[model samples]
Target: MSELILGIESSCDETGVALVRTREAPGQVPELLAHALHSQIEMHQAYGGVVPELASRDHIRRVLPLTDAVLREAGVALDAVDVVAYTRGPGLAGALLVGAGVASAMAAALDRPTLGVHHLEGHLLSPFLSADPPQFPFVALLVSGGHTQLMRVDGVGRYALLGETIDDAAGEAFDKSAKLLGLGYPGGPALSRLAGEGDARAFKLPRPLLHSGDLDFSFAGLKTAVLTQAQRLGQALPERRADLAASTQAAIVEVLVKKTLAALAATGLQRVVVAGGVGANRLLREQLDAACAQRGVRVHYPELHLCTDNGAMIAMAAAMRLQGGLEQPRRDYAFDVKPRWSLEEISASIP
Candidate 1:
């Protein structure tokens, strides 16, 4: 039987809702029907960063409306949804509660079951929603918000961690480096945009643990290096901002590309999947694509829009998990959120 899954994602500053319909074939990916998102970027922009309390309140206002929009777009009534899924953890506690509360309440009111999804797992399996999806038995480079990890994925719900950031994740490195250059909030994208205008080789920055002999990553040192360089630039920092941005981006991308290549070499996997927000980076994609092409390896990425947190990935993950039999939705209506759940824990507990 085909199941219709309604996914709610309010793990952070964005409120997203999506509907997905499962395929009849066991291993086939689910189809994304409709998705809607409301970003708190504008609201948070005044503060220069996400404020948890305000984020939670805004999510409360947006989740239901976004859900309605998704249902309308999908041409399905709320009652038609077979299951309710939500991002259960690894986000701001209040933000997570809004999604969890709404999803559970809706499920209970409909007398349906609910599934709690891991935030990172939503990212890991996101590429399945892309036009060109990747097959299993591939290495995954997950670089989102505060988490950076490399994993081997054999199938849905089957994951093995290869390595991860010991200190700041790649995204943090980008944001922190951007701040050092006086770029505003959500610095990663800002920095990347400015990078296009300057020479990447204009300034030399540290590439931490580039040859660490393991897939584990460290960006704290690199971030500090950017700070030192920016401080040294002093009054010259204004004219050299673009150059610094480019340099920082280059350092981060180089480490990511080299580490990913190393992961492929270690696993002997011919395919690679890059998910999470960093996967949308133009330079990272270009570099990784060229390197993988030369090696005769295929690389897959989530659609640029799907690279960030969204309902589509959440819905897609829920549908895949249901189809894989890795989890069964619950009907008790009692729900909880994990502010710091690890993807490894999900893999460990499932099998």
Candidate 2:
């Protein structure tokens, strides 16, 4: 019962392609064979944010080539693929269409089945791509540039929403604050790198919803505080930018960590899975590890590279869903993408 799955992802600025092999045993974890990713970071850097049209065009150019490279790297033939997988929703419509179109076309030409994957579900299951994967019945903290959410994962396709951001996500807060401090495009990582050089206690910053008696998050006030601080510093801003960045990161991380712990407590789950791009934050990992360890709770993260969106996660998610009987690949090639889909909707869609 081995099946080769080819996965495509173009939900945003990255065009990714990967191959994964499902094992004979239904419970065995799917294995990643080869994967390729092309990030639009450098191209988008000029704009200080992603430009959807350019992103879609780049995806159109990159997806096929990346798919070729992946197949070569894995030493697999296109005809050997049993299924073609692609990111379906919760992303840029045009970008999503590029991947969906390519994937469905390939599957149709090869006479193979196709699976449409949710972008966040790929993020949620990404940790399985790591050397160490968590068991079921765990709490998941999914923080990315556009989303921040906590959920109780009972098993494949079984998820319960615990809490989520009410305003800006953690990654948004990081990037927006970085922009406010004059850091250019892809501000989150830039702010994080600069934060390492400054003292976290240098400035007092707001930690939104830290004591709201609920698991919801709100980072708008924190971003506003950062804006106010930058304005107050005025000409001296450059001299103290690192401190501001550090303090801002601290504020965001503190809220994420505390809320995750609260979610674990509420769900009574002993393990927590951290996924998505923001999970790559060194400080967030350190703080969460420290806090969770004291309570004898295990924390798991995707391999550093896998924390960002990639085809491996997409392939892995599709494979897992199929293995769990949660999804069945369809033959119809006509496909659509969801540009504004939410996790709540994903939960509702799960059978």
Candidate 3:
């Protein structure tokens, strides 16, 4: 029988819970049974951004209910779970603790072991559970809410950071630029939607470090350019906002696509997997698809719904790690959550 793994994720504004079944074969990708998520976007809408304490409180309110919902949807009992996993780090301290504490407590109650999963790793490996999963040894472009990185992924647990944003992340640039245009909270998607109606070339925006002779990215300058342009428009800003939005999306996408291709060229890898929330951008997918197709590179992405933080990715990651012998679920139950652990902190070579 496959091992039933229950995963929890409360790294940010969403509380996610999922069930995954790890096949007995060590190399097989786990199968997702069911998943549930509660987003705090509406709760934070009034603030124009997430408040950490509020997010933590919401997670506390939602995690268990979501877990119960997942288990019910999966038709699995708590006693059936063999391992429990939760996002351990690289997020708000309070949120991380909420998930870790809940997972550990649940695991203890069931006499099951707990595995602490890394948040970025969940995003990176998420494509494996996609309809069309990419093989190992691919270049990965990870663009999430707070991070934008290019990495060489040899296999599960083997990740080499190729390049990353020096200042603001790609998502941050989207949100900040949207805020400049008076787009409401959770700005990225709103800005992207507005951009579709305008001409991308109407405004000339800076593509910072596009040709910096390396893969490192810089979006801070681009944000500054957007701000300066918005200020210059004065009273006419609203009329030209869509064009500016289009231009802004274009600049970020150009830098991201170019950098990703550069990483692929440098790695000499033909497969590329893009994950995280920004991967859902229609423009990005279209442009990257065209570019990668021209280069004979196979591109993959998590399902649009899975692009955001979710328990399925966390569960899949934990199952994969277990399959790879990368980490072990522990019965000790005494756990500490890390708010700033790096993806590179894990050892790639198995002991």
Candidate 4:
């Protein structure tokens, strides 16, 4: 019989739940039986970013229904879940607690074990949920609102940090640039859309630290460059705004692509996986795809919807760990949240 795992994620504004079944095949990926996500984008839209207290409150209201929805959609009873997995750290403490508390309570009632998944690990392993997943030991570029990192992922529970941002993350740079150009909240996607219609050469934004000869990224300066250019425009004309957006996007994409290619060469890894929110950038994807094509390297990304926070990835990670015997069932509810958890600190064994 296959083991069934229930994954819960409420680390931020989204409340997600998923049920996955372990694959019996030696190398086959796990099966996602049912996946559900409740995004609080609308609720947080007025606030420009996630409001921690509001996010925590909403998760409390949505988690139970989301869990029930997933179980029903999967045609499985709560008692059928063999293991429960919850995201435990690197997020708002209040938001993290809602999912952790609920998951532990559910596991206790079901008499099953539970696992605490690292948020970034879920994002890094997300591409595996697809049909043509990359093999182990590849470079992972995690570009999100809170983090920008280059990591070497050897296998489950095996990750080495190559480099990371020293200041603003790539996603923050996007949003900040967009705000300067009069674009609203969640600026990355909005700016990318406008950029699609603008001239990439009309403006020349600086590609910060593109030739620094180091893996560390610095987007804070790049954002300042955008601000300076936007200030010169005075009235923020439509054409000027679009051009600024396009130029900024191009600059960011160039830096990311060049750095990733360099990382690939340094690590001798031909496979690259892009994870996190900014991984959804159209230009970034195109540039990486084109660059990798020329070098005969493969690039992978999460299904667009899964590019953001969701339970499917967390559940999948849990399933893999359990199948590999790296994690065992837990009958106790002693897990704590890590607001600033580091992926490198994760040991092979479940805590």
Candidate 5:
């Protein structure tokens, strides 16, 4: 019988669960049987950023129902699940615990093995969930609220960090910039939407560190540039808001695309994969797509749903690890959360 893995993700504001069945034979892709996600956007809308305690509470409330829903949708008995996988780290500690606790307990009850999945690994591998996934040995740009990194992904579980943010991540820059413009919470998407109506040339924001000849990114300076421009305007000019948004978005996208290209060139990898929430930005996608097209480099991204935190990617990563014969969870093993986990620390054998 094919091994069935139950995946749970609660690294932040979303509670997700999924079931994936491995192929009967080796060297074949796993099939996603069911997937469910519950976003706490409305719950956190009042807060500018996520509240760890509230996020953990919400996950505890929704995870069980979501797991039930996914199992029912897949017509898979909980007892039949071969493994349980949960996001293990680099997220709000409290939130990570909620999922890890539940997954470990559930797996114990089912007498099945469990796996602790790295949150970023889930994001990096998400593109595989899409049709026409890129092959191994590609460059991955992981841009999100918490991280901005360039990685060399030779295969599953094998990731080499090429460059990363020295300060605020690109998505954090977007959110902060949007907040300065009076955009609501979860500002990245809101700001991107407003950017669509603005003139990209109107504000002329700085493209920080773009010419630094270093793979390291520094968005803090660019964010400061936006602040300086806003101050120069002397007030929130409602009419110019869109223009500012567009200009900021343009500068950010340019930096990202250029840095990714640099990474690709340095690594000599023709295939590039974009992951994380910021990867869903239309402008970034367009610019990267165009740039890659010009250079004969292929760019891959997860489908819109997989671009953000989700369980399918967690399950996929766990399945790959298990298949690769990585260490399995022991029943006596305790649940632990890594609030500051690093991607380079992930075991190399699974990738």
Candidate 6:
């Protein structure tokens, strides 16, 4: 039987809603009908970062409208939704609550069921939305918000953590380093843009844990190195900012690519799935493609737009999980969000 899933994502500074439909075949991937997202970047720019309270408020204002837009785009009515899915954790409490509350309320009104999705899992499985979806038994490099992890994935709800960041994550390295160079809000993208104009060899930045003989990452040190270099440039900082950005990006990319290859070697997996917001980095993608191609390995990624947190991934994850019988939806409207849940916990929770 086919089922329509309505997904809501409000884990951070974005309000996203998407509609997905389960395929008739048991093992087939679900179809993403439509998705809508409203980013709070512009709203939070003045603050240089997200204001939890403001993000929560904006979610409240955008969730319904976005949901409506998704439904309209999917050419479906609210009542036609068979299951309501939403991001449940590892995010701001207020932001998470907005999505959870909305999803639970909608499910309750329709007297259907609700499924709470792990934010990281949504990102991890996002590549399934792409044209070339990865098969099971792949190495997954997750580089989102404040997390950086390598996991061995065998199937839905089957995951083993191989290595992770001991301190700051890859995304943090980009944002923090960008801030040190006086780049405004949403530093990662800004830094990458400026990097295109400068020489990556103009400056030498540290690639922390690049030779630790393990996949564990430590970008906090890299961030510190960037700060030190910025301080040294003092008066010349503005003019040399692009070079610094390029160098910083190069260092981070090298570390990520090396660690990812190490992970693949450790697991002996021929395929890798790169997901999460930082997975959208152009340099990262280019380097990974080059590295993987040389080793006769396959690399997969979520569609550019789906690389970040979005309702499409949440819906896709929920649909896949349900299809795999890894989770059971509940009509019990009582719902809660996990602002600190880990993907390991999710793997362990499966019966």
lDDT, candidate 6, 1-351, per-residue tens? 989999999999989999999998977999999999999999999999999999999999999999889988888989999999999998999999999999999999999999999999999999999999999989999997689999999999999999999999888888888898899989999999999998999987888888999889998888888899999999999999999999999999999899999999888899999999999999999999999999999999999999888999999999999988899998889999999998999899876
For model 6, the local distance difference test gives 0.93
Ranking by lDDT: 1, 6, 3, 2, 5, 4
- The per-residue C-alpha lDDT of model 1 at residue 282 equals 99
- Report, for every candidate in turn, its global Cα lDDT versus the true structure: 0.94, 0.92, 0.93, 0.89, 0.90, 0.93
List runs of model 3 lying over 4 Å from the truth.
Answer: 348-351
TM per candidate: 0.99, 0.98, 0.98, 0.97, 0.97, 0.99
Q: Model 4 lDDT vs. the true structure?
A: 0.89
In model 2, state the lDDT of residue 345. Answer: 74
lDDT of 2 by residue, 4-73 (tens): 9899999998888999998889678899999999999999999999999999999988998999999999
3-29 per-residue lDDT for model 3 (tens digits): 888999999999999999988876678
Of the pair 2 and 5, which is ahead by lDDT? Answer: 2
Error of 6 at 235 (Å): 0.5
Clashing pairs in 6: none
Work out candidate 5's RMSD over C-alphas.
Answer: 1.4
lDDT of 4 at 297: 94
Candidate 5: residue 218 Cα off by (Å)? 0.7
Candidate 4 lDDT tens digits, 199-232? 9999877888888898889999999888888778
Error of 6 at 349 (Å): 2.3
Residue-level error in angstroms, candidate 5, position 222: 1.3
